[model samples]
Target: MTANKIELRSVNVTRYITPLREGGSLPALAEADDDFKYVLKFKGAGHGVKALIAELLGGEIARTLGLKVPELVFARLDEAFGRSEGDEEIQDLLKGSQGLNLALHFLSGALTFDPVVTQVDPTLASKIVWLDAYTTNIDRTVKNTNMLIWHKELWLIDHGATFYFHHAWDNWEKAAMSPFPYVKDHVLLPQAALVEEINDEMIALLPDEKLREITNLIPAEWLSWEGTNTNADAIREVYFQFLVQRRNNANNFVKQIQHARETLV
Candidate 1:
């Protein structure tokens, strides 16, 4: 599980295109210095930098497992950004989000994944279900698949909801090893027949060494928030520990997913 250093690209936000109002976090599609459009997640909105941390961790972890995820980048917002915005809400959000933010490369012409029309292979479906269970991601329900079909391939997105335990850090250890009951509502649960079979293989992909590498990618500023007295490295260590504990206890959730799928199908 030894990993090479992760090299996430950084981009400067050049222009704000438009806000994707569908998301509570108010993510925006904007042009970057590279002239490519990206879906920008502001650090000042919703759960603040913690959400970005979850996105970074979740997306990168998925990519490491050989899943399709849009290229993640660190988007820099200058002090003068959003100076001419007419919307007061967006202007304030921009002002608060100045400095570093997180973004995903925009997959142009991608279509929302519809479970009815598109069928995922049992193995891929099982892997996705396993990933959601491992990360404790609760956002990929039927109501919002949080997946898209780009170039006829399933691509995952919107991982800001993962690692909810950190939002209330006191019970993090308890949450880490807990079985994710929410897997019952997963959109891909019906097709995830190999949940148990893939448990060892999937867990093998995320050893403690790789987990440390993923947590190390979180920016220092994103770790310190309004109410936390903990230092950035300490917070990162907590994240690494949580992930390692979760992986060690993967069977707890693998069984849960199998039972849920059995009940569903």
Candidate 2:
């Protein structure tokens, strides 16, 4: 619960349950050695390790801001783990992802968030909107809120779609200061009446040190690729710099959120 230090627990995958076909990454409901079920995200998915990096950074940033996010863990898949799988596709996926992957503690009996039935207060709505905009998360739209209701509380999930700029990795500086036009489509935009009021408070939560802390969570294996010239340390620094610049220019996205909310309401 310390603000400065954040760590993700590691768990070895003990059994592969059925895949959650809804996720593009072919995430599965797998049991870990800890005897807990997790929604395992594979490193061999279409988005590759970048998606895992985004998920880790974004989810941890949300946690740093005092938001409710599922506990993320490093789900290890051994080389021989999935060789016996009957499904060819799954077997190939497991073969390719024979290393550290990301998983979230599975919340049983959790319901997908529906804006129609559930009402969020203006401040909470503002915080979530701020988080999505700051992270450049395009997944929290009306169609896929990416939120879960458990124990009568809202929990954020599926942050793999955030930090999309990293897919290209060249225009990150421009992206840092860019206005998130997608904020208009956020499911909670209409309820985010207090964006301006809570803007400074939320901004203060993410300092340069905090950004570095979150980006440092990305594993070295996740950063290396065949063609990329950048090393893992350099890549981590880029992520940190992007977040620091974005945090420094919070006004840009904050204004975008206010404008979008004005149009929505």
- TM-score against truth, every candidate: 0.98, 0.97
Residues 61-91, model 1: lDDT tens digits? 9998889999999999999999999999999
For model 2, residues 111-201, the per-residue Cα lDDT tens digits are 9999999999998999999999999999998899999999999999999999999888887899999999999999999999999899899
Error of 1 at 29 (Å): 0.3
Which 10-residue span in candidate 2 carries the lowest summed lDDT?
1-10
State the lDDT at 117 in candidate 2: 94
* Sequence-dependent TM-score of model 1: 0.98
Candidate 2 RMSD to the real structure = 1.3
The C-alpha local distance difference test score for the whole of candidate 1 amounts to 0.93
